[model samples]
Target: MQTRVLKYFLTVAELNNITQAAERLHITQPTLSRQIMELEKELGVKLFDREKRQMHLNKAGVLFQQRAMTMITVLDQTKNELLAVNDQLSGTINIGMVESAVSDFMMRAVQKFQEKYPDVRFNIFDGDGDTLRERLDQGLCDLVALIQPIEAAKYNYFPLPVQEKWGLIMRKDDPLAKRKAIMAHDLYQLPLVVGRRNIVRDDITDTLKIDLNKLDWRVIINLPENAKQLVLSGKYYHFGIYGVYQKYHDERLAFVPFSPTKTTGHLLAWRKNVQLTPAVEKFIQFVADQTTHKKI
Candidate 1:
């Protein structure tokens, strides 16, 4: 399918109004409608559900929307990579980050990198490690900051300075909140919210020797923010690093470090076998220089 047609589909899918989508796309309404119908015919599936004046994505449309967006992003990045081959160190670096204390380190690197290469720019995407890895695999990200238990061994990485301390997000009024650290038995009686990454979960399980399934595993979350609203209910606890611990800013929530002091470091990684843009290569070297003493 043509990229222009895909853009038309995405525009309509987002606005859910043919006239508004056509206006935003700066195209005639009839032309937009014809393009949408032809796209559906080409794929042999109805992409949208029409209800009188409004249009919404059907199941097929929803799935296609994701693929369409990915295709567009890859196209844009490929163009940028080609343009970045020139002598000028100008290109956008798509950086994926997890919500860890190490993300702070990444921002610092961004600040320094920008100061040195004013022509370059960065697009930052935040998610859990797994989500970030998926984007990196799809060539959506140029570099990603990942915390410990990184299983993507195919990618080359350098350790970031500092490590993340494991902790619990607790309601301030809870009696356990008064403790300096959370013990194993403390978790046995409490309902917990945890990350979806199995490797990290295994580390926590082996370190604490607690069976998570035996406890209340009410929900699975990719980021700490999703658990914040649940934690507000005072019925569940969130396991996260000090980044989210200090980030919540809500007076009701208290951060309690895990007893025995579990910690994990972070690494800045890039996919293997992909041609690196000049800006991305320089930024990687800059971060490596800041994080390590090794000569580049």
Candidate 2:
């Protein structure tokens, strides 16, 4: 299938409206519709569920969307790599990372890298460890920053300087906010928000000796940034690390470290056997060198 057609298909899937997609693509509606029709014929599957003015992606279309995005990412990365092969570094480095304190350190590394190689650009993608690592494995991401308990068997990584101290973020006016540290029992029967990752949830439960299923799980989120509204709602406490509150500057929220201390740190990971582009190689080396001075 032609990459251009894939773009058209994805555009339609995104807007879920043919007219809007055609307008956005600066193409006539008939042309765009015909292209999509031919694409579905070639694939031998209906990509969308048509209902009135809305066109929702069917199961096949949902899978194809991921594949299409991967193809585009690969094509872009390949073009950048080929253009920058001879060296003075003028390609975009795709970096995937989780949303946490690690970002604070990662940006510092990026700023310094940009200073030295001004022509180089970066595309930063954020997700949890599983999603970031999947992109890293698919060659969409040059490197991914993640928390501890990474897949040591499949990838090589370097520990970042930022440490993740377990904690809870709550409304500043809450009674528990008065405590410097929160004990496990403090959260008993309380409305709380926590991450949905199994590994992380297990670790938290095991460390705190609290049953997640027993407590009131008010909300479940994929990343720390999403918990802001829930915590600010004045009815919930976000179960996460110190990084949660650090990233948010709302004076109404407070983050308290867990008593007895459970901590983890971040790692910069890349695929084991793949050959990295010159730009990504230099960027990883820069992160390794920059992260060394800070005490781990």
Candidate 3:
């Protein structure tokens, strides 16, 4: 149950190769293997399924991985809190964010906060809404920025003033690129790509009153760059928010808004009832004040 051993176990679980994990951990392969073996013995259960040159998690290992992640996150936060106890203005603030136009405002707040508290440091993690929420629930991050339609009961949040419009990113030469806005029927039968999140697809169906199953979902993209590449190939249109395309516009691509103006708001959230470190609290307040005064 040592923290070091739990880290080793998690590293192995992630990499799935003993040699790779050992190299990353800066430990000998024999030592890493012995530690994992001792950990299994202590827990009284086998954790991995061994195959040639591969180690996959068993049922017990999967369960342990969840608990171990929570433990490690809590321990890291506790350590930061203890270290910052003597210095009220300086500590680590971990934040998770989804991409949005509000990022500039968030960064502005962070810059101002650090100017006042020079010793405070920030760690930023980026992901989709679900991944960000998982990190927050596990106590790995102090705050998260997410798109709207989140479960409001789960966390305290502040809505930012930015509205992200949903649109189509297509090749400049495409016929739809000449139009000011696109409609649901405009995309019908067209090969399209979108974010991998099920919620997004569901929302599109509900908003546009179009059957997603009827449309050709050519690709489900997990990365923005991949989505852009697919659209740039001139065969597909990328369904994404306006900010994303505007942030990284390609000469060959054009972003057209939705006809009905589909939009989602941005929100910053933190776990309800979790004790906040001074640095985290102060940073949140700074964001709040900035949002109140600035028109982002």
Candidate 4:
């Protein structure tokens, strides 16, 4: 398929409106529709379900969209690489990372990488492990910083320097906050704001072996900033990475580690056997080299 046709398909897939997509593509609506119809005919599958004024991707279309995205990313990267001369890196570095203390390594690596390849830009996407992994599988990001236990065989990974400590962030004035370390038993009946990532929560639950029903789960927070604000209310506690609170420091809050000192390693991972752009490859090596001494 032509790259332009793939671009058209992606535009329609994104907007889900023929008129909007045509306008954005600077092509006539009929021409855009004809292209999509031709694409469907070529693929021998209905790509969309249309009714009245709306159009949505069918199952086949959804599958095609994933492949189309990866294809487009590869094509774009290949073009950029071929156009570059010598060691000058000029493409974007798309890195997705979960919110945690381990992000310090990602940031530091990016800083060092940029210093070497000044023209290389970074697109940082933050989410929970699942979201980030979904983006990686869809070829939206070149690399991802994930807190383990990931499927080790799924990707090639470099260990990040820090083993992030799991803990509770609570108001300093809270009686439990005075304790040096928090116990799973200490959390019973407390108003808690936990991350929405099932893996993180599952690890904690499995480690503590506590009945989740016993805790007053106030909210399931996805955004770290929102979780930070929730803890500021003094009525809620957040189960989060230890060092994140250092950046969002509050005199009223304290980050107390778990009694048994639960910690999980972080990894910077990329899809196995996928072709990486030179910029991405360089950045990955830079990260690995920078953290060489600190790797866990």
lDDT of 2 by residue, 70-108 (tens): 898899889999988984888999999888888878888
lDDT of each: 0.87, 0.87, 0.85, 0.83
| Candidate 3 lDDT tens digits, 240-289 | 88878876667888999987888988898999998899888888888887
Q: 1-296 in candidate 1: lDDT tens per residue?
A: 99999999999999999999999999999999999999999999999999987999999999999999999999998888887888888889999999877777788889878888888889999999899999999999999998887986789888887688887887899887899998777787677888889898788767877766566666788988878888888899887777787777799989889877898888888998888999999998888777676322
In angstroms, how far off is 221's CA in candidate 3? 3.8
TM-score per candidate:
0.94, 0.90, 0.85, 0.76
**Candidate 1 Cα outliers beyond 4 Å, as residue runs:** 293-296
Model 4: how large is the Cα RMSD against the reference? 3.9
Best by TM-score: 1
lDDT for model 4 comes to 0.83
lDDT of 2: 0.87
Clashes by residue pair, model 1: none
Candidate 2, TM-score vs. the true structure? 0.90
| TM-score, predicted candidate 1 vs. hidden true structure | 0.94
- lDDT string for model 4 (119-162, tens) is 88888998888889888988788899998878768899978877
Q: Once model 4 is optimally superposed onto the true structure by TM-score, how far is the C-alpha of residue 85 displaced, in angstroms?
A: 7.8
- Candidate 2 residue runs with Cα over 4 Å from true position: 50-55, 211-214, 294-296
Ranking by TM-score: 1, 2, 3, 4
